[model samples]
Target: MDEPEPERKVNGMKSIFEEEIKKIQDEIDIFKSGSPNHIAIISEPYSRVEHIYNRILGDNSQKINNIQIFNPVKDTDFFSNFYSNQDIIMMQNCQYLFSRKCCGFAILEEFLDILFSSNKMYITGWNKFAWNYLKEISNIESMFQEIITVPELNSKTIMNLIMSDVSDKVTFIDDRVSEDKKFICFEECLIRMPLSNKEVNISEIKFNFNALKRKKNNKTMEDIQKEAFMDITTLAGGKYDVARKIWKKSLKDGEVRLSRIPQPSEVEISDIDELFILGNILAMDGIDFDELSSIVKNDSLLKQKLYNLVNKGLIEDSDRFYKIYPEAVNSVIDELEKNRMVW
Candidate 1:
C-alpha cells in the first residue's frame, strides 16, 4: 500500500536546515559538560530509525546528544519545538538521483561548503568529485587534516605530495577487496555487535496497554448522538449492541439465559455473524472506513451496528481508520474458536 505524504510548505529546505541548526544548538546545551562527547546521528525519512535515536537522546544520564537532519518539505510539522541545545553540530547527508531533486544531499553540501570555508570542520573523506573540487579551489592536502576514502596510491605518490606541502592525514578505513562486496543480512550485523553492550530492558519506554484502557474509560463524551446512527456510536457500543441483539435472538429461541452474559462455550459459532465481521476486519491489512464499506457493501444493518460499536468504544478504531481494534478482534475470534462454548 502507498503511504500518504506529510503536509508541505514552500522553501521547505531553508526551514529544515534552520530547524536542524537550532535543534543541534539546543541539544548541546542540554548535554554539554566541560568535556563534550562525540556523537554521530543518522536517519532517513522513510525509516523509523529516528525513533531509536530519540529514545537514546532522551536518556538524561547519557553523555551523547544527536539529531536527525531531514528536508522539511515533505513534512513541515515534523520538527516543530524540537530539542534546544547549542553544543550539537548539524550535518546533511545527500545523494543524487536523475529524476527527483535530492534536497537532503544539496543541504549537506551547502553546510559542508560553509564549514570548510570558515575552517570550522575538517573534511575526513571525499569521493573523486569532492577531492577534485577541493584541489581546484585550494591546496587540499595543506587545507585539511585528514582524508578517509578508498583509493590506490604508492609510497612514492605519498612522498611526492608531502614534499610539495600537500601532506595531510590520509588513511583507508575499508580493507575489503573489490570482489567481496556482497549483501549482508541483518542477523550478521547483529552478531557482530557486543551482546553485553546491548540494552535488554526496554519496558521502561514502552506504553502500558492497561494504562491506556484506563485512560480511555475515563474520557467522557461531551455530547451524544440524537439517534442511534450506525456511524455515530463508539466501537465498544457496536460490540455491545451486537451482543445484545444476539442475546435477544437467543432468548426468543429459548436457547440461552438473558440474565447472565453467555460465555463463548454457550454460544454456537453460527450465531455470531458480527464475530465473522470482526474476523474479516482483523485479517485486513489496514481496516479503514472505506475498507469496511467495501466488505459490508449494501448491508446497512451490519454497517450501522459495527459503526455503533466503534462509536461507543466497544471496538476501537485501531490505527486511526475503519479497522476494528486488534484487541477486540482477537477476543471475539478466541470466543468463536473455543471448544467448550461457555468455558
Candidate 2:
C-alpha cells in the first residue's frame, strides 16, 4: 500500500508532464493549421523564410503553393504561368513581388497597389527595409485585409511602424516563438467584431496592458542589439560576415594553413559544444554578452566543455576570450550535427 502511494504520485507527475506535452503538441497543430490563406513574410535577402517554409511543410505535412516573385512581372509569361497554375491550393496565388534582389519601399508600394486593385489573396516576403517603407505610407496599410509581420531585427523605426498599424482593421500576428517558427496572435479584429461596447472596452483595456509589456520587452531587446552593433553600420561591422566566410573557406580549403599548424605541445582538443557557442559569437561580432545570454542560455553548457578542451591543447583562447582551437572547432561542429543539436 505504501509503494502504491509512491506509484500514484509518480503517475500524477507523469500526467502533468503529459499534459504539458499535449499542450505543446496542440500549439504545434495550431501553427501548422492556423497559417492563413495568405501571408506576407517581410524578410531580408538571407532571412529565415526558407526555415519557416520548411517548418510549416515538414512538421505539419502541409505544402505551400508558392509563386516566387523576385522582380515585378518582368516576363508576363512568368507571372501568367504562376497565377494560372492551380496546383497551389493552400497558397492560391503566392508571389515573390520584388523588383530586384534588394528592392526598397517604392517597389513594395507598387506591390500593395497591385494587391489593392485585386481581390485575390497572396503570400509575399519582404525585408525589414521594405516593411518600414510600407509602414510609413498609410495608403499602403489600408490595402491588406490582414497583415502578419515577422520581426527579423529590432529597429526603432520598425517597432514604431508595428505599433502604428497593429489595429482593429488589421490582425497583427507576431511570429516570434520558442520552438521552431510560431505565429503569436497580437490583434484579431474578427474576434471583437460582434462584441458589445462594455465587452469591447474591457478587452481593449486588458489588451492595452499586455501590449505595453510586450512593447517594453521588445524594445529592450532591440536596444540592446543596437548597442552591440553600434560600430558596424552594416551590422557589428562587415568584418563579422567576412570573417565567417574566411573561416568556412579555410575549413573547406582541403589543406590546413602552414600558419595554422600548431606545435604538438600547443595542439589540444577543446569541447565540441564550445564550437557552436563560439561559432555563433563569431557569426555576428559586437553583440553584447548579456543580450546573447538572454537569447542563447540553452547553449551555455558549451562553455564548460570548451574550458576542458583548452587544457587538452586542442584549442587556444584569445586575449578577448574567443576560442581559436582549430581541431576542436571542427570536432564540435561534427558532434553537434551527429547529436542533432542544430534546429
Q: Per-residue lDDT tens digits of candidate 2, residues 1-343?
A: 1112222123212111233223323434444332423345443222223434333333333333444442224333444433533322223112223321233234345555655554344445444343443355455445543444443332333223223433433222222332312233343233443655433322222234454555556644445333323322122112222223332332323322323322223222244455455444322221233333433455455456546556664445554344334333334334444544321
> How close is every model to the real structure, measured as TM-score?
0.20, 0.30
Top model by TM-score, which number? 2
Error of 2 at 249 (Å): 6.3
Off by over 4 Å in 1: 1-271, 311-314, 318-320, 326-329, 338-343
Question: Top lDDT: which candidate number?
Answer: 2
128-211: candidate 1 lDDT, tens digit per residue: 232333345445345433322222222233223222332333221222233323322122122223556563422223345555
lDDT of every predicted structure (CA atoms): 0.33, 0.36
Task: Give the per-residue Cα lDDT of candidate 2 at 133.
Answer: 38
